[model samples]
Target: MNKVKVLLAEDEASLGMIVKESLESRDFVVFHAENGEKAYEVYQTEKPDILVLDVMMPLKDGFTLAKEIRLENKHIPIIFLTAKSQTSDVLEGFNNGGNDYLKKPFSMEELIVRIKSLLNRIELKPNIENIKIGNYTFNFTKQTLIHSSEIVQLTHREAELLFYLVEKKNEVLDRTFILNKLWGNDDFFNARSMDVFISKLRKKLRNDDTIQIMNVRGFGYKLLC
Candidate 1:
C-alpha cells in the first residue's frame, strides 16, 4: 500500500520539522516547504494527497497559494494552520476552498485526528438503502441524487450539505454551528454564500411538494418534510 502523501508549508522551521516527523512516523510520506512559493512548487511536482499551510508566509500568503490550488483541483483537501483566531480569518480560509482547518499552537495528535477525519470524509462511501426524502430517492454511494426521474449530480459541497440536512431532517440547523463545521467560520460573506447554496438546493428539490427548506430568521435553516 502507498503511504498517504502530505505537503507541509510553514515558515517556522522547527515547527515544520516536528510536524513532518510526526506525520512520517504515522506512515505518511511528508514533503516540506519553508514558504508558500516552494509549497506550490512541491505541490505541482508531488500532487500530494493533502496540504497543510500556514496563513502568513513569504513570497505569497497561504490564502493566495490555496486559491491557486483550488483552481487546479477544487476537491483536494486543505487544512490551514493559522495563528489568527478571528471568525473572519477562518471564514476566509473556507471561502477559498479549504476543507479542514486548525489553529496554530495545535497538538500533533489533534492534527493527525483531523487529517484522518478529513480523509475519511473525502473517501466517504454511502450505504444506499432506499433513503426516502420527500419525492426523491438518494443513492449517496452512487453519487446520484434522484428526484422523480431526474438525477442531479451534486458537487462534494452540495452532497455534504444535503447529507447533513437529511440526517437532521425536520430540525433546524443552527447558523453558527453549521457555518463553523461546514464552512470553518461564520462571517458576513460566508453567511451570504451559504444562503445562495441553500437557495440552489431548494430549487433542486422544488419538485417535491412535501419537502421545504425554510430560513429561520436570525437563526439558521430548517429542512422539513
Candidate 2:
C-alpha cells in the first residue's frame, strides 16, 4: 500500500515538528513546511494527497495559498488549521476552497481521523446521475451547477450540501441531522459553518425564482423546487 502524502504548512516550529512526527508514526508521508510560501513550493513539486495548512503564516496565509491552489486543482482536499473561531473566519476558509477546518490545539488523534475521513471521501465514487433543480442541473461528481450555459463550480462541501438538499427536496431537513451527517458534530462552530454553506447555496440558486432553501424555525432547512 502506498503511504498517503500530507503537506503540513505551519509557521510554529515546535507544533510543526510534533505534528510531523505524529503523522509519520501513523504511516503517513508528511512534508512539513514552516511557511505558506514554502508549502506552496513543496505542493507544486510533491503533489501531496492532502494539505493541512495553518491559517496564520508568513509570506502567504493559509486562505491565500488555498485560493492559489484552487486555481490549479479543484478536487484536492484541503483542511485549514486556525486558532480563530469566528463565523466569518470559518466562512472565509470555505470560500477559499477548503474542504474542512480544524481549530488549533486539536488532538493529534482527531486530526488523523479528519485526514482519513477526507481521503476516504475522495476515494468513494458513486455513479450518480445529474440532478435537476429548478433552472439548474447539479453534477455532484463534477462539483458544478449549470444553468443556461453558465457553470458555477462548487466546493466539495457545497456539492455535498446541495446533493443532500436535492435528496430531501420539498421536505424539511433537520439541522441537527445535517450537522451530524456532514460535519461529524453539531457544535456551535460547525453549526455556523453549515449556515455559511447554506447561505452560499441560496446565492448560487438565486437565479431561479422557483427554487428556495427555506429555513424552518427551530428545525432545519427545506429545499423547494
Candidate 3:
C-alpha cells in the first residue's frame, strides 16, 4: 500500500515538528514547510495527497495558498489550522477551499481523526452512480448538478449534504443526526455551517419547481419532491 502524503505548513516551529512527528509515526509521509510560499512550492513539486495549513505564516497566508491551490485542483482536501475561531473566520476558510478547519492548540488525536475522516469522504466507492433529483442529474463522482444546459459544480461538503438528502428523500432528517453524521459533532459552530451549506443547496436545486428542501419546524430538514 502506498503511504499517504501530507503537505503540512505551519510557521510555529515546535508545533510543526510535533505534528510532523506524530503523523509520521502513524505511517503518513509528511513534508513540513515552515512558510506558505514553501508550502506552495512543495505542493507543486510533491503533489501531496492532502494539505494541512496554518493560517498565519511569514508569506502568502493559508487562505491565499488555498485559493491558488484550488485554481489547480478542485477536489484536493485542505484542512486549515488557525487560532481564530470566529464564525466569519471559519466561513472564510471554507470559501477559500478548506474542507475542514481546526483551531489552534488542537490535540494530535483530533487532527489525526479529521484527516482520516476527510480521506474517507473523498475515497471512491465503486457502487455510487449518478442520481436523478427532480429534473437535475446529480453526478456524485464529479460533484456536479446538471440540468438542460446548466452545470453547477458543488463543493465537497455540499455534495455530501446533497447525497444524504437524496438518499433520504421525503424523510425528515434530524438536524442533530445530520450534523453528527457529516461533521462528527452537533456543536453550535457545525450546526451553523450545516445551515449555510443547506441554504446553498436550496439555491442550487431551486430551478426545478418540484424539488424543495423543506425545513421542518424545530426538527430538521426534508427533501420533498
Candidate lDDT scores, in order, read 0.80, 0.90, 0.89
TM-score preference between candidates 1 and 2, better one: 2
Reference-based lDDT, residue 96, model 3: 83
Model 1 ranges off by over 4 Å: 125-159, 166-221
lDDT of 1 by residue, 104-174 (tens): 78999989987777777676644644578888876654445688679876544565677778878888888
- Can you give the lDDT of residue 2 in candidate 2? 94
Worst 10 residues of 2 by lDDT: 121-130
- Residue-by-residue lDDT tens digits, candidate 2, 1-225: 999999999999999999999999999999999999999999999999999999999999999999999889877889999999888888788879888888888999989988998888777746455789998999987789999999998887898888789889999998998887667679987987898889989999999999999999989999999
lDDT, candidate 2, at 171: 99
TM for every model, in the order presented, reads: 0.68, 0.89, 0.89
lDDT rank order: 2, 3, 1
Clashes of 3: 0
Best by lDDT: 2
Cα shift from native, residue 219, model 3 (Å): 4.4
lDDT of 2 at 159: 88
- Please give the distance, in angstroms, between residue 127's alpha carbon in candidate 1 and its true position after superposition: 14
